[model samples]
Every structure is written in structure tokens, then in C-alpha cells.
Target: MTHPIPIFIGVDPRERAATNVLIDSLTQNSSVPLAITPMVTPQLEKQGLYWRDRDPKQATAFSFSRFLVPKLMGYQGWAIFMDCDMLARGDIAELWALRDDQHAVMCVQHMHEPNDTVKFLGEPQTPYPKKNWSSLMLLNCSRCRALTPEYINRATGLELHRFHWLAGDHEIGEIPGGWNHLVAVQDPAKAEESPLLHWTLGGPWFREQRTMGEGLAAEWFAARDDAFRLWD
Candidate 1:
């Protein structure tokens, strides 16, 4: 029997609705079965799985808790992690197929630098190298032994997000940029046609960001409406 593709998504109370919409979009577009879990920090903390203080630079609740995926998976198989504030416009199976076991982790590498000083919910935006690389990743869990709970709890933000625990740069792999096309930070041409679209600046979910990604937000709203229809 084929195992369902495993996926972990960041979930902040502030964006819980956004997370649901993302899950719906993924399930709607995927050709394969998926096991999607939300990385709700409070739940992880209550279980003693995550205990790190939120970094001042962290724009969202899952900024650091995301590093726990390997341990959460028992370091047994591959899994994908994605930020909640995104919409999958194509088959997630395609992204799953890009997983390369040769490397410990695979993600769409981006040189994104957002011009906005603040994002949705008035969160401060901090620029650093490889800022959004960890937002979406395919992990070879067995190869990511360095992501232990202890290390993740004490490690600096850059250490975890930039693949610092890996043996070297050679252990990191790259997926196609189209899979994580940042909404306003990347080329509009690509973000407009890309299979995956990320609202790195802010998504239309927040009242303040309702008009942030205007041209690129139709799919997000469509997915949002579809997801809420079940509840209403």
C-alpha cells in the first residue's frame, strides 16, 4: 500500500483560518493522499516537545517550532513543511516528487528581500540571508539527526533556518523556485504562473492585508471561500 504523503504546516492562532484554507487547497489539488498536521506551538509546548522563547525577529508563532518536524516524525521518513500563509496552485505530489534523499533537506532556495517593514498583524519583518528557505521544506528525516530537541531548543534562529546543523552546504538540496514563489518578493511573472504562491509580505486573510496581494490573491480567496463553505 502506498503511504500517504506526510506534511506539516505552521499554524498560528492569528492565521488559523489561513491554515485551513491552505490545507483545503492542497487536498483539492493533490493527486496523492496526504497526512497534514498543523504545528500549533501551544500543543507542542504542552507536550514538552517545544520550549523555545519566541524570538524578537520572529514574525509568526511557528518561526522556531518548525524545527521539530524530524523529531516529531521519529526521524523515520520524508516529510514536507510549509508555512500556513500560502496556497498550492498545483499538485503537491509534484513538490513531493522533487525530494532528493541525497541531501538531508530540500527546499526552494530564494534570495528574497521584502521591502515592507511590517507584515500582517503588525509583525516586524527582519531581513537575513535565506530568510524564507525554511518556510517550505522536504526533509529526509533519517539524514537530519542534528535536529534534536535539545539543539533546536537552544540553537539560534539562523542556525536552524539556514541548515547550519547539516555537515556542510553539500548536504542541503534545492527544489525549483516555482514551488515557493514568494508573492511580492519574487518575480511577478513567476509568482503569477507558479504552481505554488507564498504571501511572504502578508496574505489577504488579515484585514490590513486584504489588499496586499491583490492580483495574486484570487486563488487564495477562492480556496478560502471553498474551505468555509463546508462550515456554513
Candidate 2:
């Protein structure tokens, strides 16, 4: 309780609204104080922490920047990383309590098979083992020393997302699947079972994909509206 729990979120200009709502949801549903830091690409570039060229297949600005959390934390204590397109329906303190120091990083090992060839903004969907696993992580920074600024800037997508930095898959711990429930790729009914909702395909913020997850879309819309109402 001495310090607020550090939470690093991936942020993109296009998903600013999503990010804002996510922050609102996190604080609203958390018992503990949070130190939420958005890994904004522009700021990272300005600070000389990130300088990777935009990949055509990259859907968001923070796709690669998420790997730099350990370095950002001075490779010290534990910290969390989550995507902007998420809504926290349960207390974030629960998730924070699951952080285990035995592993380098922990995340939900999702069996994400793309339901579509493209996602929001016509971004190509590249399917691979353990896709959204990196989307949410409990980073034990000292153990993740392999995630240097130089390594992050140039590592391939497979290497970064699949956790090639760690010694083996065993080093990568697993969190409950509900913490990172993928909206469209996973079952719509299961959406209600999850504490967090992830609009990996796209969220209600995007016009065309607004209804991407049917029943689950309402959750994000409600969160967004509530966030807006609070702001007003």
C-alpha cells in the first residue's frame, strides 16, 4: 500500500476514446490506487525509448511498445500491461493480487484463431500461437531483462508476441482466461463470465465493427457512456 500499483497500457491515437474509457473502468472497479501509464508512441519516441518503423500489419501504435514495460520500470518491481480496448467489469485489485514473482511474465494463454481476415481499420489478421497473450501481462521486470530497448525496437512480431525473450514457455506463467477474454474470437456467451472484455477484433468505438461482438458490444458501449457521463 506504500505505492500505487503500476499499470502500463498500450495507447493509439485512433483508440484514444477506448483508452479513456478503459482508464475510467479500471479506477471505477478497483479497490487499490493505480498508477496507470499509457505507453503513447509519440512520447516514447520523444524520450528515445521507442523508434521502430510502423509495420503494415500492426493494428495499433502500442503493438510493439508494450514490450518496453520492463525497461520503463527500470527493470525493477512488478508491473502490468494491458490493451486499450478492454473493459474491467470486476475489481482490478483481484488481477493485481495474482502477480507471482516466480515467473518472468504472466498472461492468459488464449487460443486465438481469427474469425476474420481483417480487423478494424482494415488491418490484416495474422494468426499465430498465443496471439493475445502479450495483450495483458504481469511483468516481473528483473526476470524480463531480455526486453531491452534495442531488442524491442528490432524484434520480429513472432519473437515479441510469442515471448521469445524468455527462456521457455515454462518461464511464462498463466493467468485465468477470464482476465483477457477476447470478444469476437471467443464465445459470446462466455463474455459475461469474464471480468474483463477484450475487443481484439474491434470495439464499439469503430463504426463498421461497432457490433462486432453482438451481446458483448453493449458492455463496452455502457462503459464508454458511463465514462462520458462522468467526464461531463
Clashes of each: 0, 0
The best candidate in terms of lDDT: 2
Model 2, span 181-228: residue lDDT tens: 888778777877799989888888988888878767877888888888
**What TM-score do all the candidates reach, one by one?**
0.95, 0.96
- Report lDDT (CA) for all predictions: 0.87, 0.90
After superposing candidate 1 on the true structure, give the runs of residues whose Cα lies further than 4 Å from its correct spot. 230-232
lDDT of 1 by residue, 1-232 (tens): 7689999999989888789899999999999899999999989999998898888888898998898999999998999999999898899999888888799999888887778787777798877788899999999999988899899999998888888899988887999888998886766787756888889888888877776667877668878887778652
Name the best candidate (by TM-score): 2
Instruction: Give candidate 2's TM-score.
Output: 0.96
Off by over 4 Å in 2: 230-232
Write down the lDDT that model 1 would get. 0.87
lDDT of the structure predicted as candidate 2: 0.90
